[model samples]
Each structure stands twice: as C-alpha cells, then as structure tokens.
Target chain A: MTDPRLLPRTIAVLGCGGLGVPAAWTLALDGRYPLVLIDDDCVELSNLHRQVLYATAEVGQPKAPALARALLEVAPQLQVEVRQGRLGPANAAALLQGCDAVLEGTDDAVSKFAVNDWAVGAPAGVQRVASIAAAIGRRGQWMVVRSAGPCYRCLFEEPPQPESLATCQIAGVLGPAVGQVGALAARSLLRVLAGEADSADGALVRLQARGLLRTPVAAAAACRCQARGDGAADSEPWGQHV
Target chain B: MFERDPKQLFDRYGRQLLVQGVQFEGQQVLHRLAVVVGCDGSPLAQAAGQVAARYLVGAGVGRAVVPQGGGTLLQQLDPLLQLAELPSEAQPPVVQLWFAARAYGASADVVWTDLSPQGPRQVRAGALQWWVGGPAPLTDAVALGAAVADLVVADALGVEPLPSLAVLDFSDPLAPRTRKHAAAAGPPLALPADPGSPLQELASKLSETLQIQQIVAAESARCYPAEACGLVVADADGQLVALAVANLQDHWHSQDPEAFSRSARTAFALDERAIAAQQRLGRRLVAIWHSHCDVGADFSAADVSGAYPNGEALYPGVAHWVVSVRRGCVAEQRVFGLEGGQLCYADVAVSGELAGRSGVEGRC
Candidate 1:
C-alpha cells in the first residue's frame, strides 16, 4: 500500500539513442512521468535493433521527436517533450536546470564527461541526476551515475581514449542489451522519484551480458556523484583542465 | 612405406641432392621432386619419405634421392649408389638416399633406418618402411644394419620407434578414408503447465489487492485531514500476496501551508522505509498508494512531474490509482497510466467484497 500519488515526477532522458530511447519509454510508460527526450542524431538503420522507439519508417527522422511520437502513441497521456540537440557544454547548464532528474545516455566520451561535470557543478539542492554508459557489442557494461551523490566526473578524471570508444556503427549492439539497461535506468529513476533518494543518488548500475534479458550489477561505492556534496576545491575536474 | 627424419636426411644428403640442374621434363626439378614426394607408394612408407624430404629441404639441403626398396638390405645399398653417382661440382657431393619399401609384402617389418655418421643408428621397423642414406656410404650401411637389429629388438619388446622418412603410395588417389562418430541424445526437461502465465496471475492479484488497499486508503482519507499511504507485496504476476499498513501514529501530516512542507518531507521518509521493506520481502514495489481527499481522485501536475531522488518519475507503470472518499461513501476511484505526461484512465476489475465496483472508469 505505498502511495500511488508519489509516482509521477519529472524525468529527463538525455541521449535518445539505443539506451536512452527505451529508458525514456519505460519511465514515461511505467513511472508515468513527463519526459524530456534529448538527442541530436537522426535515426539510422543500424540503430533499429537496440533503439526500439523508432521504426524502419522513422529512419532518417530526428531521434528525439521520433521517440516522443512513439512513446506518445504507446501511452498517449505522457508529457513527452523533445529536445532535438546534442548534450554538450553549450546547453548543459540551461538544459539541466530544475530537472527532477537528468539521465545522461550519450555514447560519446566527451559528452559523458561533460554531463558528469555539469551535474557536479550544478546546485547541491538539485536532487537526482543519472547517466548511463552502455558498452557496445556482444558484451557491455551499463554504468548509471546519480546526482545528489556523486557526479559522473567524480568517478573517472578524464574521458576515454578514441581507440577505446565503441560506437554502435562500428562494433554493433544487441537491442535487448540496451533495453535491459534502459529498463534498469527507468527503474532506478522511478525509485528515486518515489523518494528512495539515497539509493537513486550517485549510483552506478551495470548490465553486462549478450542478451537484454540479463540482470544488472549495481556498484555500491562506485558513484563519485555523491562525493560532490563535500564542495572541496581540491578535487580535479576531468583530471586535467580541458 | 618408411617415415624418414628430414634432419638426418639433410645431414646425410648435405649437398649432393640436385634441385636446379636436374629437370626430368619441362617442369622445374624441385617442382618435379615435390610431385614425386606427393606419390602414394604405400600409405606409411610414402608418409615417411615425405617427412624425410621435407626435413632435408627445410634444412637448406634442397634435394634428395628416393630409393624404392624393402628392409635393411635395400637401406645398405642406397647410400653406396648415391656416393658412386656423386655429381662433380664446386664441392664433394653429399647425397642422401630415401628408401621406399612397398614390395616388402605383409611380413615386411622394417621401414626406415637412420644411418647418419654423427648420431646413433636407428631403424623404424614393422609394417613400417625405412629411409637410410648419408654422405659416408660405408658408415651409413653399417649403421643401417645396426638400426634394423635395434628396431627388431624394440618391436619384440613392444617399444615404439619414431619414423625418419615419409613414403608416398601414388596408387589410387581418390579412395581416402574418412572417420565418423555417433551423436549422443540429450536428456528431456520438465516444465510446469501455465495457468495463464505467472506474471499475468500476479498482475491480476496485485490489481485486486491494490483495489482493496485503495478502498481502505479512501476510508482513511475521509476520517483524517492528511493524505493516507499503505504498502503491499505482489508476486511475479502482480498478485497482492502480502500487505502492510504504515503506522499513522508514527507518521506526520499537516493542514497548514507551513507545516505541510514539513509533513511532506516526513511522509517522503516513511515512503522510503515502506519501499525498502517491500524490497526486503523479495517483491517489486509494484504500486505506491496514497489518498487525495478534496484534491480530486486523479494525479496532480506535481505528482505527474515528480521524480524520484534517482530522477525517475513516480508513476511509471501501467496505472496510477487514486481513491477519493466523500462523507461516508467512496465517491470516486480512478486508475491511470501516463501518456505523454498526461493522465489516461485505466480499467480495473476487483473480486470478492468489491465485485460490484469493477469496470472501466475515467481518471477523476
């Protein structure tokens, strides 16, 4: 007999690609929250398997709008807004303002690090912020970063090297892998909105397996997002200036 | 066919085996040699001769003289013939004779016999063939005989001898033997019959149980000025398997605006504990139930846009149920699933004491 009214909270999904789309959809559908679908990319055929929000017909369409449309069709009452742009330093500040929680689902290292820095630098009162780093190919790791705990930048000081970056185009990804991680992200977000602020804050959950059906591993102490509360200037940003 | 060791063959042949000067036809002599080595004189004997030739070529002595023969007698004559026919070149001719023993009938026991001057004399005997040749013909002949005797003794004692040269039998090339194995069958597995699916059953049970909890919360809303909350555990299919009511005495609520904020904060803390308790029971926190007395029996904008501390929306599910209590009767009860951040009505059907109240209802 938990409070039903405690459910619908504002959730923002950043990076509406393979991992982002399903997460946004689940949150909008399950948590019944108004979602902000964020991404700058257009739908590509390669994304068909993992990014379930888009159909073959929607290929070449902008991912944010297409995902919003798909989610609306499934759950017509959802307040799905599309932010058709990339999440970078340029708009990271304004975009993250007043958001109940922001999910960083971008695939790029720069974007990930940028989101991490932004979340940490934002005001302390901003309750929750989550980011998902999904690995590509037969096996992958999904890392969730939460706000009010540790920001993404607190964990890894620098962005991953170009050689280590795996893109959906080059390595290939399983659709269900993205789905599982996205579902986990949605579930974590729901729990956060439902007032399990401590569990949802600055937590990194990893789902590593071939199929999207496998369970994820949530790291207890891995979150650097929560450590942002110390407000110590001694901490390095990106481990280096730029 | 005798299997010959190419290293010993290279040592025996040294330099006398011709590769460039001798061409039997239009083809390069080495290519012709490769063809000759490819022949199947006898399966085992040809294998041995090929091994010997390959070893000699690999060792930089690019040519070898292959002799077709039987036991130790042929092995003895091979190097002698090679020395007699030694080519006149820049240096003394070092020739190696490879023995091919195809004519040694069924009783033919010896295949390859090594006759190198630097190492022990050894013979590969039995249905096996021997390759015996070296730079010094006399020494090679003597070693060949000793190797044959040793091979015979070893064979009688059931000790295995290594082959030195590979012999090729070029009789019928198309009839190669193939090996096969039978596949094993796996054991059968038992599966339980589906009374529908467990998930569906759980979902129905959960729906029913939540409906009852909703009724109680509605009654509490009528009696109290503040919102009411409860907790329940459902099985995999969403059936209400267990239920727990939060202690209202330990809880906080307020009628005033200033105190409302504090009450909301305290209620949030209790909500967290309830969620944790449900998780400990090994059940998903399927539904969160709360009452909205005069606020209407539908989700508020604040509720819809509210995010969990982790940033997930509150009612991200198939439905969010709201129960309104008016006076003494349940005035309005609605179930909703969010569609694009707006509340959409969901149908609910309950059994037992609430059987008559089951049907599609609008989001109040």
Candidate 2:
C-alpha cells in the first residue's frame, strides 16, 4: 500500500499553454489528484496547434478558466480549480501554498527558476516538487526537482537574460515538440508523487531532434538546493531516508 | 510566405515561419505534402492518432488523410489542413503515421517517402515504442503520440536525421529507460495487422479450472526444489483431470550438466514417452502447467521458446498456465497464449492450499 502522505492530494499547474494543457489533462485522467490551473494569458488563434485544450471559439478567453471548462467537459465529475493569474515571485508562494506538487510549463525562464526556488525552499509541512519543461522548434527539455536532488538552478546555473533566449514565439515550436515535453513533465511529477523519485530526480531529460537523452545532473557547490534545510527531512515521507 | 495569401498564412503559421530551417522553403514543402494518420479504433490508438494529426496540421501541412467520422475536433483544428478520407493515387509525397497496440504497451511508426527530383527512392522511416505498466495508458498515449508527431515534423522540415528506433520502457515505474538505437537492418515498416487471439478463448473457461487449479497448485508445492510438470487432459468421460509427469530436467542435468546448464529448480523438461502414452490412450490434452519457484507469474521469454519452438506451436490449441510458487507455496497463477504471433498473458488469482505428500509421477 502506498503511504497516504506520499500521494499528492492537490496538484498546481503553473501554465495553461501548450505544456500545461496536456499535463493537466493527463493528471485529470489519473483522477487521483485535484488540479489547480494557473495562467493569466488568453487563448489565441496561434495557440490552437500546440495547445490541445483550446479551440478557435475560445481564442480570446483567459487560458485558465477556458482550460478548466474544457477539462470539466472531458470529466464532468473532476474537481478543477481555476486561477487566472501568472505565477511570479510576488504570488508564487500564495498561489501554490497548498499544492503538494507543481507542474511548471510557463514559457518564462525566470518564472521557471522562481518556481524551482520556491519548491526547494518550501517549509517542511508542505510537500513540493516542481517539474519544469521548455521546448522550441523541434527540440525540448524537462527536469524534475525536489529537495533530495539537483534543482533547476543547479543544472542551468541561472536563468538566461530574456534577450539572450529565443522565445517559442520567436523561434517557433512544433506542436508535438512542446506537447511531448509537457507529457514527460506530467510523467515526472506523477513519479515523484508516487514516492519514486530516484529516476525522476538527479537528471535532465532532453527530447532532442535525434533521440531522447537522459543525462545525470550534478548539484552545484554553491547551489541553494545543496543546503540541508528543513527540506532535507522530506526524504522521510518519500521512503528515501537512510 | 507566398505572395498570394501572405496574411492568412502569417496569421496561422507566423510563429513556425520564424524557425531556422522552416523559413520559407520548408513551409512551402509542408504545404505540398500529405500525411496519413492511421488508428485501429482502440481508445488509446485513436487518442494518439488525433494527437499526431493535430501536430502535423498545426505545422501547416497542406493535407491530412486521417480516419474519417471521428475527428470532429480535428476539423476545427485548422482550415488549411484539408482532412481527406484518402490520398489521391497521384505520386504526391505522403507520410504515414501508424498507431498500434502491442501486448505490453503500444507502438507508433512514421514512414515518409522523399520524392526529390531524382525520384521516390528508398523510404526513410522511424518507429517509437512506449512500453508501460499500470493503468496510465492516457499518459503513455500522449507521450507516444507527440513523439511520433515530432518525427514527422522534424523529418519534413530537414531539421535533423531521425533515429531508426526509440523505446520508452515504463515497465519499471521506479526507473523508466529511454533507449535510442542506431539504424540497423530492422524489419521493413508495414501496417500492423489485427491478429485473432486464442488467449481470450482459452481465458473464457477460467471458471471451470477451479479443480484443475487446486491439483496443479498442490502438485507444484510438493515438487519444490524441482520443477513440477503436468498435462491437463480429459478422461473417458471427457472430464478434466490432472496427470503429473516427472520433470526430465533433473535427470538430464545430472547426466550432462554441460549440455543442460540450468538446474531443475529453474527449468522444466517433459518426457516424450509419457506424452506419447497419454496420446495413445486417446486423452484430449488441454494445457500444460508448470511452477516457477520464486518469481512472479509472468510468461517469460524462455517459457515462450519452450512452448513454441522456432515460431511453431507444439500443440495448436493447448493453453499454457504458469504457477508461481514462493517459498514452497503457490502464490499466483497466470495463463499464457499466442496473440498476433506474440506471447501474451492473462492473469488468474488462485487461493492455493499447499499439500505435503507426493503423488504419482509418470516417468519414461
């Protein structure tokens, strides 16, 4: 039997775009956890390709509520909480306070790192693990982060300047590229929630143009995730504690 | 962007146009190609097919040949993506994406003909297999479908060379592996055939196997440290009865360990004379049941070879049941049979009562 504490009761999805749509749908199909959808952006005609939830009718609508209504149509009995708000440093903690796990699919790199920091520094009472994913053109990458393994910052060091990176809009992302990354993100979070985090953590999974590559990620010497704070004891509930 | 309808194309595919290789030339190429997404109507395959189709259409592909009457949402996906029931017989460059359900999980294959000016030469193809455990078929479908779509879009746009095969092994939920093998002399890509299942026909009679289950479990526990073998046959009255046969694995191993490397504890071999005698008595052989000392009730590769040598079934309709004996007690039992020329399994739970005394064992 799985430990009740190990199972996530509530999951918070940080983006309702290409990645968030499929991730939330997969989680909703699992029917084990109630989802909290968060995104302030509105649907657009261009998003219909990659983001499976929205149609042309819902193009001008806010993403979170529209996605919630779409998921409800698939599973009328599903419990879906919608939050039409972007997750930034100001509201990241409050928006994700009760969520046991976070699936971050937002296109913003800074926001991805912010979610990572918040999850790594979360208080002991709150169980938090973040799966951050991004894709551009024909390639994508995703990673699972928790207290026990290398966090997002440990692998990438720091978020690149917004000017340095080509946004999905600028470089253009294939629908399947981003969708696969989102599905993998959801798979990673589900693994962490099931108390099977060894494979999910400590690695960066890249869906390259050639093939899928999973490379081990080492924690930086000065990385904040290396600090054995109150989060270190989190291994107890996950059955990883020595 | 074409000078005739730049605004409309820009409105829908402006983002993808900004991509490196897919600038203006690739977009024109995509618009001329037709992709066919095939599904076998299983819930998992259809869902995956829709996912792949949506990606191809979204990338501004000119036309899509998909299964008709199911993709109402796909029609709403894009107006430029002409949904067709069949591609024209003309020599247009076409890509094929096939979603199939296997015994373990599911598989997707993408085959595209590169019709350059030279000619439609050898077709380039790639395959993706997602092997999953548990009831998370939806997640695997999403991942598998999206991966297939990536292969099509990337190959169409000339982004990079595609790997011959990619396998996602989620059988071990704790540690899933993503293996990408280099191109080799693999079997040619073909449409997946829907083969008839003999396993389902055999499994329908599970309720009548209660007495036979008890006998097999008892015989298995008593024959611990050496594999127990038997044949389920009908008597003169056409009633099912268990006939325990001595496993020749131990005898052969003792005589020639080098020739028969595995011990009797792990392997089982039947005596041809005992089987011939049973056939001579005019008994109908139904199944062959054996025990695995300390493993789960799974039809392993060796079990398949022992039953079907060189892809030929020893007995055409004989069902194979594997009993798992953990610590000298029958833990569980499962039925193994053929499906699509592959070994598949059906699980059965048995409340086995461990017996002590040894029973009659037929020898050569």
Candidate 3:
C-alpha cells in the first residue's frame, strides 16, 4: 500500500490528451501530491469523449489550463501545475526536475524519443530515477531507468521512419482503449513511485484487453544514454542486465 | 445468496475471487467502481466492451462508460458519456481507456481492453515485450477483458490483479487462470549503445556507405539460431567487402554442455581464419561483426571480455558491430569499440545502404 502522504509523489504529465487526462485525473482524484500538466493544444469537439478532464463547454480552451481547472474542481486540495507549452530540449529538464515520474502520452515518434533522451540524459551523477509509462494504440508499456536496468533508448534508440508511423487519424483507436492504456500506465507508474522492489526492475509490461506480458530489458553495453558505464564490467551480454 | 441477484450472476466468479483471497468491503467495493473503456467496431473491442460493462454494471458499479472511438458516434449510446477521439495537432492510433476514474479521487481507475491491431501485433519497447498474438477463442479480447474487469473490480474493492497478468480466458474450462511462463533461464543479453568514441568518425563513414550494416544484417539472417561471425573490410577500390566466419560455438558447446547449454545461441567466437581472410583480401579488418540471433545488437560481457581478453584490444584501430536478428530478420544493427578503457557504441546510419539496397545485391 502506498501511503501518498508519506511518499509525496509528484508527477509531470507530458501531454493532456487521452492518456494524460486519465493519468492526471486519477492522480489528482487520489489526492496524491501536486500534478503538473504540460501541453499546448486546446480542447475541441473531437476530443470530448476520450480526454475525460474537459467538458463540452470547455471546447476551444487550452488543454493544460482546462485540465488543471477541471482537476482542481474535483481535487481542490491538490495542486495542479499547468505549463501551456510543448516539451522541447530547453524546457524538458527544467519542467521535469524534482518530479518523481514522467507519463509519456505524446502522439509522435519525435517527441517520445526526445523525452526519453532527455530523461535518461539528466545531468550525470544526478541519479535519474524517473520511470516512464506509455499507452500507444491498445497497449500499455512501461520501464524504470536505473543503474541496474535499461532506459527507453535501450529498446528504441531511433524513431520510426515518418511514413512508417501510425496516428489515430490513420489507424483509429477505441476511446476507452486509450483510457485503459492510460489506467494501466498510471498503475505501472504508481508501482514505480511506490518503490515496489518486489516488481521486476527495468522489466517492461505490456497490457492489452486479454492479458499482460512482461519482458526484461537491459541497457546496451555501448549505449551513450548516460545510463551506463558506472560499474564492474560484466563479461557476458544476452541474459544478464549489463 | 439471492437467487435472482446480479451477485448470483457472478456467484462462481465471485467464489473464485474469494478463493483467491481478494479483500473488499463485501459487495460495496464492486458497486463503487466507475469504469470507462474505449470501444470500437472491432469484434474484439466490441465483445470486450460488452463483457467488461456487464461485469461492472452487474456488480453494481457506479457506471461503466464505453466511448466509441474513431469519428463515428454510437447511435443509442448516451451522448453525454460517449467518449470522443481526442483531436490534436499530431494524430496516432492512441486510445485512452481510463476505466473507473469518473468518481475522481474518491476511486481508483482501472482499465481492461484488448490489444490494438494498429501497430505490430507484437512490439519490443525497451525492456518491455508486448506481443498481441494469442490463440483464438480462449484469449479473444472479450473474454480477456472480462477477466481484467474481474481483476480490476476485485482490486479497486482492494485485491491484487492475480496471475501476474490478470487474464481471463473464459473459453478455457478454467474460466479464469493466470498466465505462467518459465523464466528464460540463462544470462541476460548484453548490448552497449551510443557512447562517444574516436572510431565514431570511421563508424559514420562505414554506416553512411552501408557497407557494415548491410553485411551484418545479411549474415545474421543467413545464419539463423547459431551466432554468425564475419569481418568487414574495404577492397583496393574502396568497395566494402564482408567475409563470413564460422561461429565455432557448436564445438565449444559440446566441450561444456552444462557450462554452455546455450552457447550456440548465447555466445560467439571469431575464427582464427580471419587473419588469413584479411590477408587474402589485401584489406585490414576494419570491423569485427557478429549476429545476436537470440539477443539484441549490443556488446555482451563476453563480447567486451573477448575484445579485451587480456585487458587490451586484440585488433587495435578496428571496431566491432553486432546485428540483432529476430525471427530470421535483422531487427537492429549497432557498432561499438573500446576507447580509453571504456566500451562505447557509434552511430550506424541504418537508413543508408543497409536499409535500401537488397542484401544479396550488396554481397561482397
């Protein structure tokens, strides 16, 4: 059981759409620490359903502020910080500093990679303990970056080719499906926040309608992502987390 | 037990939950849940929607919201609650299913949905392995969704999502059972990535030319199961050439079966013939390349130790590249080297010749 009062878990949500909304909603409603919502987009007619934090009348309003307003109404005691902007290299470290975890809900390959690069690249010697969770399509995946595990870059160092990428416009996803992913991502992040040492370290868990699968991932030996090269040189590669 | 009660409808399931030692405030916990699922026309999603809603609704959950995704709206779905596809600058097949979040902070949100077919049925992201290909009838979205719902309801009411994954395969006689898989027994895969290196310039040149990547991809594919070994060198005309070398793991595995049960799949040893091959080609071994058929493209501890067996680079001024071959296809290709007592990787432009040209055409 994670006693929110004692842990003081603060989360920095990178986006406020489908995934971000539920994550924020759940965290705020749970009254768990301060919530920071970052996004430049606004609410629109099309976003009414899945982005649960906003209402119909709130359409055309900026999302970060709108979400903060909506969440505050439900969780007045909780602090909802809104950064009405996108996450770029310049502001990422600043916005992310001191946060316990980052929930990645961005819609493109570029931003996702940028977030991972920045998260793992947090100034050297500064133990970057932020865990990441994502709800893409119908799947929920998450990993914790630590000295003993793999970073987001270890799994995907490069972004997918532009033409190869899929968006909601192209490949439609169910509304509640993203919601499910959001919930799953939130749960995984909570586990990370709780310091659940019993949970597999750096193991990625994928959740779907039917079941969830977990696979252990390790940092590449020569990975440059500031996550490696600080220990005894283990002599083997495939099965052990290097 | 009331005969006509909704709890009766879930008598057997409820008993199963009880048997699993799920703690709750009796039935009040289930009734307090507010679940919202993302629904679409897909049979899997649609089926999953019905099953999950029924379980929560039947259990007396506060409300179960199913938002029809895509541009289309559900005909009779309460328009007030039907979820809409989020519109933003960048659109991707992202569906947000925030089940049980409506009560706000008063409740814990739980999600139960099927795998989306938008991306690879199976995806490997970081240390996470997400595979969606499951056997039919038993693992369909609807049945699985119900199991997940059971787990969530039980959990919100204060229970653990059982069986690690919390799957419900009603199609099976067991009705609800957790998935169990023996842990992959062996050492984990070692793959080092992007560290600053002096060989990066050379690595960039090789990668730009597609010489190293293409050859590594092709050889890794050519030699399945067993690790593939090769050397990348340039001809007099500056054309890159790749020579195949025997993995020799078969011999090593036989020598020490228990010590190296997975040697053929896990370890790799370059042949001594590499010296002769380099001399014949009149080219220095610019890079030592191998394939990881079972693991990813990163230098293993064995790789690092093998490179600097006696605490030094065996082939000075040369780089090492590893090809990650999954299911007989080249999944990733990375290059690495030892610089200043540290092992680091260099950027290999995978988009170069390695990606565009046919492996057969690039041979030699």
Among these predictions, the greatest TM-score belongs to 2
- Candidate 3 docking quality: incorrect, acceptable, medium or high: incorrect
Candidate 3 residue-wise lDDT, B138-253, digit = tens: 11332234344544544444433322222222122212223422113211222233334456666667667655556667677676766888887877876777778888887878
- Residue A138's lDDT in candidate 2: 68
Provide the RMSD of all predictions against the true structure, rounded to 1 decimal.
35.5, 8.5, 25.1
List the candidate 1 regions with Cα displacement exceeding 4 Å. A1-9, A197-203, A210-242, B1-187, B191-364
- Candidate 3, A129: how far from true, in Å? 3.7
Candidate 1: lDDT of A74?
A: 50
Ranking by lDDT: 2, 3, 1
Question: A1-242 in candidate 1: lDDT tens per residue?
Answer: 23554433566788887568656755654535678877889976445434544555667888888888766765688887777777676776677554656666778777777666665554443334455556554234444444434445555657789788656555544343344455445555554554543222453443332112222233324544433533333232211222
Superior candidate under DockQ, 1 versus 2: 2
- State the lDDT at B126 in candidate 1: 30
RMSD of 3: 25.1
In model 3, state the lDDT of residue A152.
67
Which DockQ values do the candidates obtain, in the order shown? 0.01, 0.47, 0.01
Which segments of model 2 are wrong by more than 4 Å? A1-6, A219-222, A225-229, A237-242, B1-4, B33-35, B40-42, B65-68, B85-94, B111-125, B133-136, B161-164, B170-186, B191-364
Among the numbered candidates, top DockQ falls to 2
Error of 2 at A186 (Å): 0.7
- Weakest 10 consecutive residues of candidate 3 chain B by summed lDDT: B100-109
What lDDT tens digits, residue by residue, belong to model 2 across residues A50-72? 88667667778899999998778
